[model samples]
Structures are given as structure tokens and as C-alpha cells.
Target chain A: MSEPRFSVGQRVQIADRTPPVHHRVPSYAKGHVGVVERVCGMHANPELCIRGDGKPFQRIYRVRIPQTDLWAPYEGTDGDKLEIEIFEHWLELAQ
Target chain B: MTGHDDHDHGRTFQPDHPEPTSDAALVGLALRELLIEGGHYTAEEELAVIAEMQGASPENGGKIVARAWTDPEYKKRLLINGKDSIKELGFDLEPYEFTVMENTDQVHNVIVCTLCSCYPRALLGMSPAWYKSRNYRSRVVREPRAVLSEFGVDLSDDVDVRVHDSTAELRYMVLPQRPAGTDNWSEDDLAALITRDSLIGTQRDLSTK
Candidate 1:
């Protein structure tokens, strides 16, 4: 497969998936906007379907978002940040 | 329920018995011995890892802390995509996954896999035995301040306490800020400053002695 396209500091949102099972992506992060913090070297995509249709894809990006943004009504530390890794397929540029 | 009780009551227990090892247990023991023999880790390290396996959450937290201290950008990334972010640290999210919550001056974050010991094993090595116990999981969220106090983590009432339920694929690791004593310390020195308790939000960074 072709290398996935993403860059550091780019704004992106996690792609929403249906009937989420045990997944590495956080539920609160689904549909939430975040900034690309780092481009982690490639690795096999862990998310798999029973049919095995989605082959292992690479290009994972470390994304960061302010905790206040993730938790609405968050009245705590302002600059606190939460980071997570996202596969190329699970992200799209945020408008 | 009555029929099952009757059957159990009628069953006699045998005192003398040979313990049969489960396939899983045998395999695990063999793997552990092999790892030790190969010098992948020392007996002490193996013991530590095994003790951690008794409780899955703490080990996972250790892994995350190790990675965060080692890599700068990865630390930043962890604050973004906690679950997915760990993969960048060279950990595989397998039967379980994790979510990361950061604690700061104004806010405090704690995680509990209430139903079970849902933990970030990839980043942390294993969870503490207490973490897997039902008593801890059940009571911590209800009385966070009290529970934290038990671990000597006394937060002011002004600090916002956030409890994360690590039920789904997400587990959590607390990324404590580097301590101030070792300002010019190298990565190794910085790493030495981090203890398992600090990563789990139980204790603060070690002071320069």
C-alpha cells in the first residue's frame, strides 16, 4: 500500500467507527479534533475485522489535544494535554 | 440453583491430590524460563514482571513511563492519542488497549477498569495486584480523594479530580512532569527519577538526595 499522508501540527479528527469493540482509540476522542504532534514510524495496524479484509497498513501519527477540549466543562489545568497514536485510516483533516 | 446446590452438597472432596498444571500455566512457565535463560532479563526483572502480571495495570503504566522518559516527542504524542499513541513507542495493543489521562496542578486524573483490571499493558509492564482487586476498583471512583490519600497523594479540594473508567479498549497512564531537582540531568538520570508510583499518580517524583 502507498504511504499514508499526514504531517506534524496538522489538525485532524479521529474517524468514527461503528459498533466499536476492544480498540486502541479512546471513545472520548472519537469525532474530536486534535493536532498532529508527531509522525511515528510505520507499524502494522492492529484494528482488524473478522473477515480480515483490512490488511495491515502502516503510517501511525501521534496526536495531541488539550484535555480541556476533550472534556467539556473541564475546569482544571488549562495547558494539560493528552496524546494518542492514530492510524492513517482512522483520521481525517479537521475543518 | 437448588438442583446445583444439591449436586454440590452430594459431591465429596478428596484431600489427597496431585495438582495438575493447566496448559496455559505450563506454557507461561516455560516461556518465562526461556526468557530468563536467554538473558533477556534477570531473575529479579522476571520476578518484577511476574508480580506485575498478577495485576495488569501497574506493569502497563511502567511501560508507558519508560517510553515517555526515553522519547521526547513520544511523550508529547502520548498526551494526544493515549491509546494509539503508545504504538509509536513500540508496544502492540493486543487483547487489551489503554487510554492515557494527564494530571496537572489544577486537575488530577485517575483510571480504573471497574469491571476488571483494564490496563495499558503495552506501555506499562503490568498492573499492581491491588489494581485488579474488586475492592479497589469499586471504592476508588466513589472516594477518589480518600483513595488517593491512602497512597499518600493528597490533592487539594480545589484540584478537579477526574476518574477514567478503563472499560473499553482504552487504558490510562499518568504522565508526570519531570522533577525539578534534576534540571540538567540526562535521560538516564531523568528516568531514574521516575518510579512506578509516580506514573500511577500514587507518589510524586523523587527528590534529589
Candidate 2:
């Protein structure tokens, strides 16, 4: 990844789309909103690498999402949350 | 068993004649042979690596956690860059970004791989059998608190449970809070308290008893 487009503490949403291909963004995190918890540096775009193409590297971020938002009536504590690594392409600025 | 026998030329693995188990074994066999044929490595070298990995006990992680307990400065670096910090202790976690999640009075952290069974093998050795099961990968992210209870880590409703789902390029390790009664304990003694499951956040509260 040339430059990181997202910053820590900024709100963002994981791309909700599901393509029937090998990808890094897990299905559960799709379409959910989370905050960028860490800029995990650049990595080879996994989607491209799956097709044996690795030219483009993409920035990765660790997004922190409240468990309640991810699962309604989440049984854990109010502060319970999940942090997952999402690539730059799978995320968008959320309101 | 048959592993050493097969590698020692007991059975010819032709890609065209693939059996059920042979299909998966094909990938590893091919790579191993290629490395040997290319002179990039030898079977002895390969076996040595396998031996080293097999010998790499979870104590590797215990040593790191124990050192972090005694050295605040090392702990800070470990939280920031877990890969490098562990390497400072002669352990290597290459190619992947290793992030250490700390557990405290207010928050408890757990590690998982929802997409597949990814783990920080180079640091913590092989993942536990339960970690690779579909049940864990699927359930832990959705109901972490309940799963922690099943692991015998019943928490007080006040503590926040944070789950870290790793990707192919990244790995996470948990830095559990040090037990209170062992301030004067030696690093080796403290390390004995850090269990493999504790390093993964499935277990907490290292007991000096």
C-alpha cells in the first residue's frame, strides 16, 4: 500500500459485499461499522494474490467494533468489542 | 510412522495418481522435494526445522510474557511491536505482524481466526486442537463471554471481552495481567505460571498456587 487512507480513531465500515472468492474480510464483519484501532502497515492485496497477481500492496487497519452493534442483544458486557484486521479496500468512511 | 518412510522413498507420489490424503500431501511433498532438488535446502535441513518447531514449546510464549511482567519497558515495546520484542528474546515471528493484546481489570482479550484457523505458530507453537475446530472459530467471535466461561474463565459481567480475529498477514498474542502475590518471584518461576491458553486469552489469572 502506497499510503494509508484511514487514520486511527476514525469511524469506518467494512464493505458488505460478498464475492464467492478467497478473501480476507470475514463475512460477519461485512457491512458493520467500526473504528480504526491500528494502522497495521502495508500487505500484498490478498484478493489479487489469490489470483497469483501480487503487484499491488494495500494498507491494512485493525477496526474495532462494539459487540452490540455486530450482534443485537449481545450477551457480553456493554463494553465488549471485537477488533479485526481489514484491508484498505474493504473499508469506507462512515458517518 | 509412515511419514518418514514415505519421505525416504518408500512410496512414489505421482501427481496424476492422487489419493484422498495424497492430494493434500502433494503440496507439501512437492515443496519439500523442490527445495531439496534445487539445492535451496536438504532433507536434513528440513527435518531440523521441523524438529525445532516441534521442540518449540508454549514456554516460548511464557518466557516472553514473564519478561514483560518484570520489565515495563519491554512490555511497552511488546504491546507496540510484538514480533520484534519476542525476537529480542531469540524467538522469531517473521513475515506476519504480531500484535500483543493486554488484559486488565476492565477488559479481557481473546484470540481467534474466523476466516480460517490462523495463529502465531512461530511464537506460540501450534495452536490448540480446540482453536482449529470450526466450533471455536465460528462461535467465539459471536459469543465470546460464553465461550470464555466454557474455557473455565467465568468473568464478572463488568469486564469487557475483546476478541481479536487474525488475518493471514497478522497475528495476535495476549499479555495477561501479572498475578499479584509474586512480585519477588524469579522470571523462570513467573514464566511457569503463564499457560499456553492464557497466552491465547482463553485462560486468565495466572495462579502462583
Candidate 3:
């Protein structure tokens, strides 16, 4: 069981890689940088559990991504935000 | 297998007859059969379980919201741990995390499960049909303003929108800003304003007007 690498308020980028397997990270959020909203506790690795292996538990974080950064020609206010839960492996600390 | 044929094949089709069972429904039926056959749970037990789940409704959530509006201490606790706070009111979201999003003057919160229909059933009862639709799951995360406006909740530009995607174990409920002209209203009256859609953040500005 690995401790959480990212803390709340830290900037992290979603892993751009899209493997041909089941995952929780939404496609629109892939490769985008977002701030960690909250550090959710560990959860069973869904990607692994689907294939019958649930040994490794993962630390999940709620990442807050601005809608303007997500969609080009954004029509909503700059304050508009989209927050989603991302597993540890799908996120990397971004500059 | 009745196709809309131009030829008069049937005298009259039953308007009440729905289409064949969907693939997901078939799979669910199969799983239920297997479980019953294996003596895991009796058919009556399954019915009882479903009956309890269907019995849940938004009124349970309204009680909590009304309490939070009237009690500052309970509100603080509810904001910190929604699942536990609700247990005080005889409702719980165990085996899952329940987070309450407070709607302040500038921040408006909405809940959606983009990957799937992961709703706080313990609070909002069963998830509405639209909440589980692909159209909402995809569009709300993108054009939230448009989607919100369609629901008759038009927010000002200063009010930031936060769409909480319940993709994981956690479930969320929005604590709407208490309506005006209700200062003297009892908790029962206040609870009446906490509609299912308002709790989900699709409706804003709860009012007696």
C-alpha cells in the first residue's frame, strides 16, 4: 500500500496514455493539468479488479479542472470548473 | 418483433406493450436467476430488498438540509462528513463516502456521474432516468451552462459552476442557499423547499415565491 503522492492544492496532469483497457479517467480530462481538490482515501484498483486481480489498493484524488482549459471556444464563465476522481497511476505532478 | 410496416399486418397493436427486454435487463435477469438457483437469496428476499430501496425518497435528504439550515453545529459536521451526519437523522451512506457541497453566494454545485450513474441513493432515493442517460452524462460536463439553463437554473456570470463528477466511491449532495422570506418558517416548511432537483444542484434559489 503506497501513500498518496499528491496532496490537496497541488497541480497534477492526467496521464495522456490511453491503454486499451477499462479505466475511470474520462477522455476529456486526459493529458490536461488540474489542481488536486481533495485527497480521497484508498480504493480498490477498479482497472485491476475488473480483470480479477484486486491486490493493490490505490489512493484517489478529486481533481478540479477549469472548463475553459478543457473546451476550446469556451462559452461559460472562467470560474466554471469540472471536478473528477482520478486514480494515482493516471496522474503525474505537473509544473 | 413488430416493425413499422406500411402493409396492414396487424389489426391493432397493443400501445401498452413495450419493446423487448434490453440487453442490460436480460443480464440482470440472468444474474438474479443464478443467485436464486444457487440459494444465495430467495426470490422473496430479493423483492424485500428492492422494496426497501424503492421506499427511499428525497424527504430523507430534506430533513438533513433543513437541520443544517437551522443548526450551525450540525451544519459544520454535515459539511465535514455527510454520511455520518445523516446517520444522526436515521439515514446512512455506508460502504461509500458522502460529501456535502455547500452552495455559497458565488459557487453553485451540480452532481453528475460521467462514467456511470453513481448517485447518492441513500439520500436522493433512486436515480432519475435522465440522470442515468448518456446525453446528460456527456453534455453536463461540457456545456454545463446550457444544460443548467435547460433545467431553468440560469446562473449569473459571477457565480462559478462546479460540476462534481461522482466517478468513484464518493457521492455528493448540494446544500442550497437557504431561501429568503423563510426566516420565520419552521424546519418543516424549509424542508419542503429542498426538492430532489435542488439537492442535485439542477435547481437554484429556493424560494417561497
RMSD to the hidden true structure, all candidates: 11.0, 4.0, 7.0
TM-score of each: 0.50, 0.90, 0.89
Best model number under TM-score: 2
State how far residue B119 of model 3 sits from its true place (Å).
Answer: 1.2
lDDT of 3 by residue, B107-188 (tens): 9999999998998876789999999999998999989989999999998999999999998878999999998778898999
Provide the lDDT at B38 for model 3. 84
Give the per-prediction TM-score of chain B.
Answer: 0.64, 0.86, 0.86
Candidate that scores best on DockQ: 2
Each candidate's clash count: 35, 1, 0
Pairs that clash in candidate 2: A1-A57
Query: Regarding DockQ, does 1 or 3 come out ahead?
Result: 3
- Candidate 3: segments with Cα more than 4 A from true spot: B1-24
DockQ for candidate 1, C-alpha atoms:
0.08
Q: DockQ of each model against the real complex?
A: 0.08, 0.81, 0.76
> What is the alpha-carbon lDDT of model 3 when measured against the actual structure?
0.85
Off by over 4 Å in 2: B1-22, B27-41
User: For residue A94, what is the lDDT in candidate 2?
Assistant: 98
Worst 10 residues of 1 chain A by lDDT: A74-83
Candidate 1 TM-score, true structure as reference: 0.50
Residue pairs that clash (backbone atoms under 3 angstroms), model 3 = none
Which segments of candidate 1 are over 4 A away from where they belong? Answer: A1-95, B1-73, B95-97
Q: B34, model 3: CA deviation in Å?
A: 1.8
- lDDT per residue for candidate 1 within A1-95, as digits (tens), equals 46558888899998877454545565666787888866755554555644464366556676776667876655345554555567777889999
